[model samples]
Target: MDKLRSLTLFLATCEEQSFAAAARVCNTDPSTISKAVSRLEAELGVTLFQRSTRQLKITAAGRHYAQTVRSSILALSSCEDELRQLNDAPRGRLRVNSAVCYGHLYLRPLLKAFCQRYPEITLELSLDDMHVDIIEQDIDVALRTGFVKDSRLVARCLSPMDFVVCASPDYLKQHDMPVSLDDFNGHSWIGFKIKETQQLQPIFLPDADGVYQLCELHRTHITDDGEAMAQLCADGFGFAQLPHFLAKAGLKSGALVSLYPAFRAPMPDSGVFAIYPKRAYLPARVRVFLDFLVTALEAQQETPTHTWAQHWPPHVQFD
Candidate 1:
């Protein structure tokens, strides 16, 4: 029972009084923790905790078990730390997840460098636009964009990818250019859809007379792929809004044009971050990848699109 994680978590649940709180401390799911506790109660054939809708009260056996588990876990960690000190290098599989556009547009190069740095570290990279359960998925770290919400993981800001309003050169030349936000009403719009929601997301832009308004978008073409939107917009389909960093190359190479230079409103909360489970010691692989990502993003910002335009293709290299 002492060697089993379910038993250990059962003790943690009784001590914490809440399954969610124990899950956070142990870096697991709340449901998993609760199930473990329930299983422990069934196996022991004693009601370890008195459960009510309002609170969980620990029985005498629960308190005794919690105390015993706490001391034993601590002792095990102390023993493990001495052996870990002898192995200076962190050699393990480091799993990472990121948005598809962000992953290809940014981290591919950075990850290449990271793999070079730590030859022993195996990377399992998953690219998806939707939010994922890092702990449950066994993800070591994630490079995420926009707002950071989870308190269970520690977030480190890597960079801010500024957003912009864009349209195809041909489309802008064919139609009357929108002078202000209210001007958007007359234009055919391409929008981004969050896959998890399967609904169109609002793209905030300055409305009539240059007043920023979070307008509900009525999109003619809405898709989950950011690249698809950009491509469709480039093909003179409709105006699409995208991150400035993403459009910078297209804007330079005469593929896409910034719709409103002055009114390309960037949201204040759109900070890119690297999130990871809260651990006592961050593994070297995670640190190395984060450092590489920061360096790559900073270099991208410092060197203008024209600098890369001469060497690299104008549109997305990967997609």
Candidate 2:
């Protein structure tokens, strides 16, 4: 008698509480399920179930044993999946989820190149600023920042989400440019009301020495969207602490000016991470894309934009 097979049959019987039901679930005869459960009981030297013609009942020990058996079976299944994935090619639809600003600033630029490189893989990208359940939504990958508390997902750090306090050149010219930490208290701020929490997020800034100061910013204008807040700041609303990815283009274009660039420090729990659902067998397409992103992001950090064009495939073009 196969011990694993017998254990599986026993667990199925415990769940359904009927040999016939377990048989239907396992696609086997009722007698086979019954014999397997009986064999399992004999091997364990325990009567796992109290059986009768009318109904079957699980013992107290059986209930406790089922819990352990279920976990072991799941681990075995995951191992089997991993083994199968080892031989599988990287062709398939790779579903990705990301925030809007990150998608536009970071991911959107890379898609054409990624598609060209992996012609067999089809990319299905979904953008939403709000957090969605990755497993429930069937998203293969998610580009996200900040702390990840989900135990069911694997988060690989790509970059630090460096927060840059900046505003429009016109706004800074109208008001005093924040030269010191004490100067921020005198300034009005464009506040971001978080959609998830519905509260105005406190501004956290760091100085040259890497010490952080928290500010309960005086909100002159409020919006739930990060992009909207950035646009408002660029339109000369007030000072806003924006993520570097969102502010980089504006800074380069002279639409926004970085306030105290020398004072920038790493924000706590702030990271750009490629998050994916935890699985033993990560699809090859998803794995390669993640590797590509890590390499691309590293190059983007090290090389200047004009120089980055040289790294691209000759047939691919970027502006």
Candidate 3:
């Protein structure tokens, strides 16, 4: 007989006080229970029970053994329960990545609420603008702005990359705000340079025909950092077209002023997206985080329609 099975049968027989009764409880024959307990007593070199034809009574050794093994049995049952919970609930270390500005401005606040709701989930978040290989870096989810070209990954749109032209109050006070596209001709511009291509990031604006056009601005100051460009714009360095994530608060607090509220930029594919690797079964934690992020970002916007404008033409580009 197996040792664990023998121990269980022995304990049941001891507690029930009769082999026949223990067999009834265990759904086994009385002879099987009798043999298992006899084997257990032999292995332990202890007389566990004193049996007579009329009644069966447990020895002192049998009572002591039952008391000792009861705690171990309870602990084993508790471990099984924990394993079951691990399979059903979202409770584990979750790795996530996001761009610096968006992480700080939007994701940072949402994290507190998410943690509070799911206290069992441990989160590891990395905030940076540098491109990362999610598989290589072991990242479970990534919040990025712009095109997601990797076929190995699945992308979900979080918000539109609505470019808004803004300038510091000091700069606008010193120089007139550009009301038309032509007014940008001689103004000092703070621009963004592509890190990989080393070329000026294309500025998309509308033409006289209401169609979108791209103009590569000649910049007096350029950087590959989004936050730096926004800061320079706020510090009165020059005018910059910044994403709403970086420019919204400054515009509201009067540190920066928006130019041409009616004109919208053309960025069909340049939207904030959450990317994750293609997998047959995505973890429960990742799915919950992605859904929570979308809800949190929407709460900060004026309206869903305004946050994602639909007037831009489909895949329009300029050579």
Candidate 4:
């Protein structure tokens, strides 16, 4: 009789409390279960059960041994599961979540290529402007902008977020271009409202010393959506501070003009991140998706489509 097989049979007998019941559960004869338990008892130098014709009763020592063996079996099973996951091919449903604007501008374009590369992975993407609980939502991975403070998650910085103060060409033509921070006094402002907090996002302006300071500007137009806010600004509403990802197209197409490109907010939450729940073993699907996204983003940086850093002064360095 194999030792592991004997242990398994012994545990089954302990759980069932009857050789016949254990035999039925293990798909063997009652005699086999009895022999395995008897051998286990002899090896341990203790009588594990008080067997009578009517019922089988476990001793205190048997109960304690069962508890120990159960935990060891569970630990062994967990190790085997982790090893299997590590070696398994990437094939499963991968649930991904992303912020709305970033998903539209960046992630959406790369989906087809990712799917073509990993045909085995079924991709399910959810785009929301509001933050979500990845663990509760059963999300495998998430793309988020700004600083991630959740202790339960692991965040990798995909790119640095840059905000550009911009206005439509018509608006800049009508109003004096803000050459200095003092010139912002009478200018109309278009602000972005955070739907979650129901508060307007703060505007950070650089002082004469180039230090960013939060300033309150009267908002002439406000919207929770980044695209809508950019549209309102482009339609000659007011000066707005927009994320580079949102402002890039407008600036390139000559719809919007970058105002005070030298001054930028040193926001604490200033990076686009790839976020996921921390685990001992990462699934192959998730690992491949992250790798694909990183590679794609790196390729985009090599082209003019995502040249966000080019808008900044040459002296500034980003990681």
Positional deviation of 150 in candidate 1, in angstroms?
3.1
C-alpha lDDT of all candidate models, in order = 0.70, 0.75, 0.75, 0.79
What's the C-alpha lDDT at position 157 in model 2? 76
Which candidate's TM-score is highest?
4
Better of 1 and 2 by lDDT: 2
What's model 4's overall lDDT?
0.79
Residue pairs in clash, model 1:
181-206, 181-207, 182-207, 182-208
Q: Per-residue lDDT of 109-187 in model 1, one digit per residue for the tens?
A: 6777778778898989899888786755557788776655777678777655555677787897899766555667788
Q: What TM value does model 2 have? A: 0.66
Which model is ahead, 2 or 4, in terms of TM-score? 4
Q: Which candidate has the top score in lDDT?
A: 4
Per-residue lDDT tens digits for candidate 4, residues 1-319, read 9988998888888768899999998999999998998898889999889989899999999988877786566456446547888467878789999999999988999999999999999999999978787764558899988645888689888877777777888887798666667667688899899887899989987677656689977887788999988899999999888887788788778788775553435667657888987766577888999999988888767221234545543221211
Candidate 4 residue pairs in backbone clash: none
Residue 171 lDDT, candidate 2, scale 0-100: 83
List the candidates' TM-scores in order: 0.67, 0.66, 0.65, 0.68
Question: Which wins on lDDT, candidate 1 or candidate 4?
Answer: 4
For candidate 1, the per-residue lDDT at 268 reads 61
